[model samples]
Target: MPASSTDAYITDFAEFVQASPSSYHAAAEVARRLEAAGFARLDERDEWPAGGRHVVVRDGAVIAWAAPEGAGPATPYRIVGAHTDSPSFKLKPRATSSSEGLLQAGVEVYGGPLLNSWLDRELELAGRIVTDDGGEHLVRTGPMLRIPQLAIHLDREVNKGLTLDKQRHLQPIWGAGGDGEILGELAASAGVPAEHVVGHDVLVADTQAPARFGLDGALFASGRMDNLSSVYAGLMALLGAPNDAEHISVLAAFDHEELGSESRSGASGPFLDDVLVRIGAGLGAGDVERRRAFAASWVVSSDAGHAVHPNYPDRHDPANRPVLGGGPLLKLNANQRYASDAAGAGFWAAVCRQAGVPSQPFVSNNSIPCGTTIGPLTATRLGIRTVDVGVPLLSMHSARELAHVDDLAALGAAMAAFLTPEV
Candidate 1:
């Protein structure tokens, strides 16, 4: 509750977002933090180890846990779930093209991003690059590219409405020349030879750093905040909780949630289930014991939610408008788009009360469709009680987003309390 604590958490969160321009970088950053906190890294090929702090990374997905001392197969896990990937423009295989003497990098839109937000911004490329030797290197090119929007003189009706052609208008101009030069630049940035760079998974990102601002400097804004904020809170809560707590505290940051979570590392995949099973088996849990543990387990699917738009208040449900700095918002959708049901909602309310953290509720207007998160997919996959929650923000999937500094810290407190044993 100290001001210093909140400031520290927000500062760290901003640094995390700055370092993580892509899902791979995000996972790597999480792994780095976990290791720095004394969590050992585990390999899937090796036999599972006994009780201790450990982290496992599968591409852009990461699962970290701190097992309680003397914990067994039937011990329930207090899991905090989130995603790492954000909507951006992914560089295509043949990324080089020339348009009217401008060298542009061909790109494909990944997920539903506010395309207009990306126009006329300083952009950089970051992600993992694979060399012919099978070695993977993480590369961040800084602000080396720009997507210049058409001038108002060229499109006079831009104020009324604008339609973007993803294939035609989304290419970002990097420099003069062609593909060979761009490939060489990427290779040099990655410290590899151009010929050796066989493949890559990279995305363009805003180069501006996150900042705290407002009349009183109470708000924070940054990129990848839709879920990185949750990932950071979950990590802090798991690390802050005592290792001997009653439940095994697990932090799962998966990837590809923006694109329906169908990838192997996504929520719909077997990543969480597989890891849980391995943990149970290592604890000598039988099938029945694993089921029992799951029955007692719960998941807090944390992602960013929409704050009532000040300019378009009618878009939100009148009765369930959430505001920034109001504490974490509990997202509910009656159509199962979100996993929070009556029981889950009651349980989370109890947890918030115990943590002494204020809570808010959010439900989208029936006239508009609701967006889905990992909440429902995780619940369906694991059959665990799940509640969807997040910090309320204005820009949900823009190149840059805003969130409350106080709510960010409050989320960590709530998760820590949930991991702690009920007295």
Candidate 2:
């Protein structure tokens, strides 16, 4: 690859992170790119398009695929699955609250986030807001609502680590120092009256777009890297897939992986299975055996892996410290936190070799338990061969995260090769 190709990855990463304000936005962006490339959209509400047309499922979760104009069955569908959601603060039903005359929105921590990193940063609100005009309608207010942090003088225990009470301390103060109807203000921004706002699933997002870092500008700063990296890579792979296949190439991005994978849109739910059935039915092959064959298909469960922090080198396994720009990592754990088995890891390694990309393996120190992802759950649910792989990242759950600029391209290249591999 030329020097220009690396620049393209940084530029692409910036745009990709900005476009994905929320998981829904992330899924929508994937759908948008696939649709532009001649893929047709399918969901519970609409009939799947004819052959030569790519099929997409928009179950609030989006799964899109393209087959050759007349590709046959038994093509051994290549799959790249990722989640759209990340750990962040979610709004409560009665979100508005006030303390000491300052208006704030009550929030619940959605996942295991770095609580301290969010203490004194500029936070913004973004997500879908529901309204009842005649029935129900969706309105996306893409504005940045600032959440200012408290000053040092207020609490004398400055250096000491504080336990964050999710219910009491995590709510964000949102106004210019007074208690009032903030919902009305938000409603005005969305072009809806305050009282008409029935419900919302709002999240606090970093307003900063991803940017190049380091004196040489080798690193990149972005939000939602924990999973969005996988989302973007998978999208590129699905979009770049070739015309020949033993099975359909499916890209499924679930919405609630950060929480326990139990929600309708999470990995443990019926979303993936339902979408597979829908696609089979739309293709006029909705038999039990075909569905069984689909379940036997393979999946690449993509998510971010924690790189050994340069400043804190002892935190990683001595033999397996994945470095920046090294390559996509095959994450393994004896505890099954990650889903990679010998067969799955070997498959990914084969793809890396074919793509001419260097790869690494990561395992948490035995003293510390590793985190789980959708890899295992999806494998169990569908009995599909699944592997866990991701680019190495720093500040895993902080307000702002970092990763090498080239790794994005590396991951994308490897994924593209995997999705369109020759039979």
Candidate 3:
């Protein structure tokens, strides 16, 4: 049975937002989905297996495979990679502060969040809370805080796109007259005392779920669209792929991509290398052979690409503006920023054609410097041919983002086709 386009898009978007409060949650939900789909989980501590299955790494990354039960050696992998982290407010090491008899939680913005959009929205805290038990991982999921906006009388010039000083007025206010210990409050909810909880990586996100808008039902507004959209699409593609062993298809969802790829679970680390080595070894290849195999493989670095704004159309290239519901767009930047090349683009186009999927081209304005993703990094590190592509989105890093709901279905279908093309 096939899921309808609307059902797939809406359900996927909701699940994406729910499972992805942080990188840890994103990876956990991915692993759960893989397990539910009859994919076997591999132990990172053990040697890689010889056939197709799923492997979880670092609890911040996941690699799912679809290969024939047994195949010849030297069959290179085809990978679709995306990151799970997005721009939001992260709790500082010491998360509590008191200012003028009000309680607030200290936060440092993650990635490139639209600072102004965060004002006056109901904020929530969700992420992992580590306890002294070493394995007791608790996740808090709800609207735990709110940041009230100032009255118009207080900030009369706010309508003119005013700037916000992050350190001063951005923190959320909670429990007007409660005890000053928000940590203790949260710990009580988690069934633990504040002193028993050692550390946490808390995130503040919009509590609103994604929904359909517009008269024709073409609009989709959600959170974490910068990359989580890609993450969800990649996961669905892998899950829907045929369980054959000709060419193993893997999805690499990494964390910390928004912060320059420097973290342990980022694309710049040893996570991907270790997984490829394990996969090659599963197919009876050694380290040197694995390196050679990886070099011969290919990757589609799946991330969101910018679309031309209707009001500010001049900000985009006239010939290459990706429109809403126009299918997936191939992002290209000349300064080696996007990791796409002649070979990679040709491969992706061929795959789309074979899968009967439509695709478009995307290039930034000549006068503006373009942003980048994990595409180039992965291409350079593994020596694999890589291409960057994504659904056209609006308000990329805002508390709430927008895209075409149908575009998500198209992107997922295309990715699924790429994962499992007819032999």
Candidate 4:
């Protein structure tokens, strides 16, 4: 790829990360972009027809697909799966609290975020707010909150090793001895009355915009890179890919992967299954034909993997050391943690080669415990072949993470090829 293509892809990605402050925002942004690209937006409560590009949004999840004119019963699905949610603090029901003249916002750790990374950053509150009439509205406060860390002078041993009390120490201060209601603020942001807004799903997000920095601007830093990078790649690939492939190309961006994907919009749930079944039915598929389609289908679960850290070399596997700009990772595990088998690995290699992109393999050290993604869960749920792959990042889950500009573009290229797989 030319330097110009890499630069353009990274610039658009920075804009995407900025627009998507929460899962809800991410899903909405993707649908909006797809719509702009001439894809029709479909409502789940309504009927769907096959043979064109269409997208559907379910809460913080979105599924988009393009079926060719010749798509039919045995026309399998080529799905690129990703998640919309990231680890962050979630606002509680009673979101406002006052302590010792400092007004704070009540919160609970939503997922396993590096809690220490949440310290002393300008944060925003963003998500969907629901009205009494069951109407949902997206709301966001650009930079209204902060979780300040205890001063070194006060803690004295802060550098030795830092510890945080999730309940006690994680509340973000938004005001001091003032009559400010977090709910009211969210309601106003959404143009709804606080009394009329009965429910919310707000999350804390970093306010700092993504940037290209480091030597010769090769490195990009941003929040929510773990799965958003995959989501964006899948979206770009789907948008730019030819819709006349032999199979149905689908982008399934689910929510709540950080929480084990159990919710209705999660990968472990029926979101993807529901969409696939409906698409098959629209193509005049019987139960037996649908089964045959599943047997021929594939799911590429793309999330973020780790780049071996310079300081803690022992933490990473010795032989397989993936670097920042090397390429996307073909993640594997001895257990079914990642669901990447030899067959899946070979498929990924062929896809990368077809796209003219490089690739690498990622496996955890024998001594360390490995983490899992939506790969195993999706494969088990649908009984379809699935492979785990992703861009290598310095910080897997942090307030801010580092990635290579070229890797982001390379992942998109590889995904585009996987969607239309010539091999």
Candidate 5:
């Protein structure tokens, strides 16, 4: 790709990160972009058209597909899988509380977040609120909260090793010296009545905007890039690929991977399979034909991987040291934690080779364990060949993470190659 196009891709990725603070917001932003790309919105209760670019949103999950005119059930699906949610703090019920001269918001740690990274940063409460009338509204408080770390004076050993109590120390201060409901601001942002908000699923999000920095503007930093990088890459690849490929191309962005992917919207659930079955039915496929399609289908499970931290090089496999801007990583594990086997690795290598980009291998150190993605779960559920791949990042789950602009574009190119047929 040209430098101009790479610059535009980075700009668009920054815009995507800014627009998506929570999983719900990520799904909404994806649907918005899909519609802008001429993909029609789909409803689950309604019958689907046989052939078209269609997308559907179920809670925080989205599945979009392009079925050519003569596509059938036996036509294999080339699926690009990623998640929408990231590690963050979630608001607790009756979230208001008080500390020594400040009003705070009670929250629970949602996933494996680097607790120290969240300190002293401005944050926003973002998610969906359900009204008494059963209407759902998206809400966000731009910069309403802050989780302040205890000063060095208060904790003399802070610099040596900081320890935080999740319930007591992580509550964010939203106001000084009085009780205040954070929901009021969320309601105001969404233009909804605060009293009508009967239920909510709110998350604390870092308010920092994504940026490109460093000596030559090669480094990109942002929150939620762990999975959003893959999500956005898959979206771009799916939309830009030829519509008349031999396989039905689908982009499956699920929620709750950080929470072990057990929920209905996660990859462990039937969301992707349900959509594929419906599409097969529309193509006059019975159980056997659908099984045949499943036999031939492939899913590229794209997530974020470690890029061999500079300060902690020993934490990664010494033989496979992937650096920033070193193209995308093909994640592998002997325990099936990443679901990338020899066959999947070969396939990904060929795809990246065809796309004219370098591919790096990533494996964890012997003593240290690596976090898992939705790869094995998706493969187990759908019985499809799944490959684990992603862009290399320095901080895996910090409030703000680091990535490379070149690697982001390279991942997108590889995804497009994987989804398209015959080069």
Candidate 6:
């Protein structure tokens, strides 16, 4: 057979992740794709258009949707939600430091990352910089830094459990210089005067490019797979769905989910809620109609789920182990860590079946605690029935993560089915 949809999906996903080094870039990239698809940009401060495709963006979040031509105010939405931010190191305001004649950038760990995986890797700086004149620029310095690991001879006990101090060992060497040198480089790259650089939100990322690996290239590895994979999957599904579908199809990519999602552009904030309300108002909806719309709507919170590790078999639940390439997984937790319930899960399973896609179930081992996603928060805040699902992945929060190429395509199909009203 010729190249399957999975092959094409993986190819596009690799490019998306490489282009999106930070949340700001990720949102901008999503906007770029939406605009290319004939979606008009809508400013939050301006009145929303009544129908057709439109998109609204906040700092690091984006929401795009296509309303049915004759849809009423009570028409529910088929929404797919994902996060843009991943675990990485955020540069400090005063980010200049030096030790033993080596220049380093002061950094703070953002969210929970596998610290050891970042050591000894070539790194690059990427994020948004705000100029004094209110101009915001996305800057990227490819392969400009590294965080070298200490020689094993110096720490003879390296074979044992390794511990890293966030402030001490996690700083990445940028070269021999202070803040001015770094600022000058960023200014030149961003094409702005150094004096006009009043603020910045810079972060470090692995410089390694994404690639297909393993026998037959079944496995794909790259950085920022924790959530970007889901983001891309959702985008593809939204763009591929039938335009004349009954329900309004929405794609919501939020920011700061890796950091507990408390920011204005995060799931726990008012971004999604505000947009929904505005959309309802633009459709001539009253409070009751808005509530009715939400009550009838559904949201699928897509993130990266953990795959059963070959070496750590005992860590996964015996009955609910999820494996890469098996299929997309429906995440569940009785404690509400995930919002999936019997009805929501059934709905998703039916969507998968209709799409001719396979799916698996995932539950944390009784002995281990589970991680939370935006599913529960979206359900609670919007009063919309929600389910949590994802493609199984390995080395989730590491600088480089792995997932099966087949599973990526399966997820895209499943999401597209969910967005299709006929399904």
- lDDT of each prediction vs. the true structure? 0.90, 0.76, 0.79, 0.93, 0.91, 0.89
Model 6, range 26-88, lDDT digits (tens) per residue? 999998998999889999888778878888889889998888878788989999999999999
Better of 4 and 6 by lDDT: 4
Clashing pairs for predicted structure model 3, backbone only: 67-244, 67-245, 68-244, 68-245
Report the lDDT tens digits of candidate 2 across residue range 179-217. Answer: 566556556667788788887766777776688878678
What's the true lDDT of residue 19 in model 4? Answer: 94
Between 1 and 2, whose lDDT is larger? 1
Q: Cα deviation of 419 in candidate 3 (Å)?
A: 0.9
**Which candidate wins on TM-score?**
4
What residue runs in model 3 are displaced by over 4 Å at the alpha carbon? Answer: 1-3
Q: Which stretches in model 5 have alpha-carbon errors above 4 Å? A: none
Candidate 5 lDDT, 1-423, residue by residue in tens: 677878999999999989999999999999999999999999999999786898999899999988876898699899999999999999988988787889999899998999989999999999999999999999998998999887788889878887789988899999988656888778888898889989999999999999999978989999999989999999999888686788999999999999999989999888998999998999989999998998998999999999988888778887989989899999999999999999999999899988888999999998997778899999999899999999999877999999999999999999989988574
Q: Give the alpha carbon lDDT tens digit for every residue of 223-329 in model 4.
A: 99988999999999899768578888899999999999999999989999899889988999989999999999999999999999999999999999999999999
| Model 1 regions more than 4 Å off | 177-180
Q: What TM-score does each of the candidates earn? A: 0.98, 0.92, 0.94, 0.99, 0.98, 0.98
Tell me, by lDDT, which candidate is best: 4
Backbone clashes for every candidate come to 0, 7, 4, 0, 0, 0
Which run of 10 residues does model 5 get worst, by summed lDDT?
177-186
lDDT of 6 at 371: 95
Candidate 5: RMSD to truth = 1.1
**lDDT score for candidate 5 against the true structure:** 0.91
